[model samples]
Target: MVLQMSSNQANPNTYMGSVVASNDVVIQVNDLHKCYQSYPKPIHRLWQSFMPKRRFYQEFWALKGIDLTVHKGETVGIVGKNGSGKSTLLQVIAGILQPTKGSFTTKGRISALLELGAGFNPEFTGMENARLNASIMGLTREEFHDKLPDIVEFCGLGDFLHRPVKTYSSGMYVRLAFAVAINMNPDILIVDEALAVGDVRFQRQCFRRIEQLKEQGVSILFVTHSTESVIKYCDRAIMLDDGELKLTGSPKEVVQAYLELMFGSEKDTDALVKVDVENYKVEFDPSIDNCPKQASYNSGEHRWGDSRAKICYYEIFQNGAASNGLMQRGDQLVIRMWSLFEQDVDNLIYGITVKTNDGNAIYGTNSRALEVETPAQRAGDLVVVEFRLKLNLLAGDYFISLGVAQDHDVKDNIAIDRRYDLIHVHIRETLDAFGIADLEGDLSITLED
Candidate 1:
């Protein structure tokens, strides 16, 4: 069932209502549904028009019973698989497409980046297109002229602004269009995967500008398939499945739900169990498996995947004993994790990554990289994995992320379980280091004389 509860009210797991009440609400959508009539041939459309009352075209609902609300300064990320009405919803909100049923409302001016060169004419120069696009977004002639300098500088188009848009590449076109849309001083910004066309640096610049707009109280509706960006920038996220709102909540939870839906098999019925390392019977060598701390069962500390397997506990050992959050530079460390299998997993890959506290990835390696062979695991089986990593890092706090997935690095490989920020390690500086890692530079500055 579709829940239409207000954002200001208690957001229960599921409920039903007609309106989302909020004093600061900038966008409200209630029981929104969009349908498109598809005809098999051109003659069918004409015949339907002549019949008047008879139906000839098939009805397709791209959006089904969508209820959402956004307030001032809120950035909502929309995600789903392809053909799930992401683009249709954005088009409806941008006034480019009208709903066949239900309704929606938007307060304040909205500038959208839905189509590439949407409001620009190919015959017109970049300068002319900028003026035309700004004017279409409700900017007056005086306002357009006043913002022209800023737009040109933001686009980094220099003298190319005088050239006709038909001669420009896709990146150049998006740059100009994005610059114009943002410099219009809009109260709401709607992006629909248009930023994916630009290069990395341009995308970064766009996101930075979006952050600035967010700070200035501009409501944003963003649609993208990138989960990392959704987690990093969105305050709230909603997932759509087959034209239905499947989940809506914090970014991490929503993204996790989406990932599980895409990769997970049938749900398992076994309850989670934590076994103490010292007490549990050893199936393997006790010397290699024993660690100081007890096994932890905190599933809340990380995001998980399908229930085929799970990481029950993890710890880091320095030298021979378990280390408690402290490690020195160049210390030999062993990272170990215990996995509990709920379903048969033929092949598995163990992966580890080290990142800065701010989530910048410093180093990453997988079992595949080391050519390590893992035995096939069966249901009810427990496996222990230990990785030897050099502590050749600069003095700073870092996080470790772990994951177990299918035995491949391609897109088809499914993650059996994954955890972010699963372990935190702090390193005390013993020598001068400037970057995230100490490259171990060799000083051989001998005198030429």
Candidate 2:
């Protein structure tokens, strides 16, 4: 069902830059700017209003010239560091805050789970608050009545739902708040990072409910610091840096860009070099022809680092033969990365992580972890780092990521270059397994008389 609410916001014809909204767009923002007037003293706020020419307040732009569009039934993740205006943008879209310059339009019944218990009154009972929240979310009287029982049951509060909200614990607060928000059947769900307060079980339940909502064609804008949630749930992601849009793309790629913005130095992401490894020869295992023969490294995959060094190419070798994507259980595998040092560096460390398709880490290793000492590197030098390990994994899809960092005394752990999901491999099912890894343990069943 397509539920829409009339938008009284600014005209859709106005734009901040070149952003144009399409017919399927549910939220359209053009040249959106939100600023707060900060005063040095409480009296200055009054003085600035009357002084006109004399400015007594400092302007802090929470959002600056932001233009974006969110299509229907899309779950977009918003990520940024603290003070990056992630919450501010969400509030603006949720209609809690008005724009300072530009205008935005939002369609549908928007229910926002922003700050914890934002719409609830402390003195009100949980039932009263739930009713109030449902009304605010545009639920009809009969609709809320029909869904109230389900909401109460999902919250698992029993008689506590009749108690005042002030007496509730933080976990209970989240349960009631989330229950009301989801049961109201909003067309657009806006969630901030408030779910972290709930316990693990409740958090998982909330994720499942959100997934259900997405399947029902509800648009969701989720703001979180959890990169795993973005990669696992969101179809698209946007990174905001100091109130500016830094990147917008697929979840994995955007998460990679966000990590680079946080951990590595800012550099051109398009800078790349090709590896010429044709001269190197390795004995082939002709029987293993099903393995992927090449790594899918392209501009679609996020890459970033300082220009001091770069990873030219990375490849996986199956049983001494170069392969990319196919593998079997208990097979000997070698991961080789060719790196070129563009500038002199004292010491370099190589790291690799084997992860599930959803970004869960199965195994990870680094030069520092393996007790291997890296020699000093000079400019115009090429180095090949290889990791050989038995593929003791179950039948599933997995990814390998590569990173190179410079070790220093004062400022250690500087990334020279890093690439996420550098290669993909699928472990062919050979044994009946259920979990992550094949421990290769013997099973014995004996019953005592």
Candidate 3:
């Protein structure tokens, strides 16, 4: 399912421009085209038999006239719905699938965690497959022997690493595949949602390893559906649709545009939603036009979206001071949400989550998380929700996300009001000091002498 949410938020229009403002090119993709010959229909197939086999051939272009470039050390993301030719592009990049026309170039050793069981033989034992998997990734028997222990440890497969490849669970298969790919020491690592194969713990492990690769200046091309992950990990992102590159920019902007296209038409979706987010401006007053200086906002970090809900209003307040995305350390951060109901909805809930600049959830609070609920509201009822919590974070960028739920907390309902108002905080907290909050810890020093 394409899980999407948009919330009422106060955000700036400057985000889309900030995405491509950088100058770098690590991966250059020229007029790349990959087309597969499709067979004709049954009647056409029979007719082609009477005529010639050539008559039944139809060209289905997967990658058509593509041009792009990746800067050195850039972590580029590839996002598109299923059957969007993402897999085909990666396969061509890995040289596993040949392009029908045009040419592309990569200046480094390549490693990929594409599809599971990509090179493994089902009949082979896990141990046998492990060796073969590493070899196919460009390692000799001796090098794999030296790195075997590390892969086993990272994968956490334990004895299962020695078991038959076919006997492993789907999760185990992914873990092994990831372990082998990362340990093979590739200069250009390509990951295609294979990281989602394992458990949360394993997923965390894979991300940490990806971090290591990035630090070492290894170029990465990741294809995933998780907008949050793309914003967190990718230096930049490229969005594709129908084998065509649509938007290229920072994760949030691309994700927002992609979501609007996937969920519905780019226009106002009041039918599927209730709150009219276009009229929802809460933090900065209408006079500011989303600027930080003129309004209560003191910082510039923020994100926004329409969680698919008719998100009406979202505001951030610190000690009664109105702000869009600025919060000081040791202050009480209060997020207020207001939405107009368009239906007799049951189990309607509002939630707010705070994340660091890199997209780490500092904390989250929802109406249902507190076991609170509002009586069923009418079509015109305006629902207001607020969350108050302590702001305790080291100085860095951060974002706020608002969500609307119909039944459960999951985005099963027509979550419309997913807004990403930019949140930039001047964290006055000192991190070297102990404790979760920025409050100075109790310390004592006594001279025995």
| Candidate 2, 1-449: lDDT as tens digits | 11123232243323233333565677888778899998999999888778889989889998988877888899999999888889999888776788888877776667677786677888999998887776665677998899998998888999988889989888898888888878876777888887888899999999999999999988899999899899899999999989988889989888888877667754453444433434444343222221233554423345567857777656678999877568888889898777776666776789998889778777988998898999988765677899988989989888778889876564457778777677778988765677778898678899999
Q: lDDT by residue for model 3 over 19-62, one digit each (tens)?
A: 22233433456677888866756687677778884567787788
Q: lDDT order of candidates, best first?
A: 2, 1, 3
Q: What are the Cα lDDT values of the candidates?
A: 0.76, 0.77, 0.66
Q: Which regions in candidate 1 have their CA more than 4 angstroms from the true location?
A: 1-23, 266-299, 328-332, 340-344, 354-363, 369-375, 378-382, 390-399, 407-411, 424-449
Q: What TM-score, over all chains together, does every model reach?
A: 0.80, 0.77, 0.72
Q: RMSD of each candidate?
A: 7.1, 6.6, 9.9
Per-residue error for 135 in candidate 1, Å, reads 1.3
Clashing pairs in 2: 292-324
Can you write out model 1's per-residue Cα lDDT over 1-449, one digit (the tens) per residue? Answer: 00011121233111223334564877888788899999999999999989979999998999999988889999999999888898888887776787766777676677788767676788989998887776666678998889988998899989989999988888998898789888877777888888888999999999999999999998899999888788788999999988878888988788778877766544353653333346446444332313224332222346567657777667678887877768888888898888877667776788998877655577888887788998888766777899888888888888788888886344556778888667778898765667777788777667786
Q: Candidate 2: what lDDT?
A: 0.77
Q: Top model by TM-score, which number?
A: 1
Which ranges of candidate 3 are over 4 A from the true structure? Answer: 1-27, 37-60, 134-139, 264-294, 298-332, 338-349, 365-383, 390-397, 403-418, 422-427, 430-449
For candidate 3, the per-residue lDDT at 347 reads 63
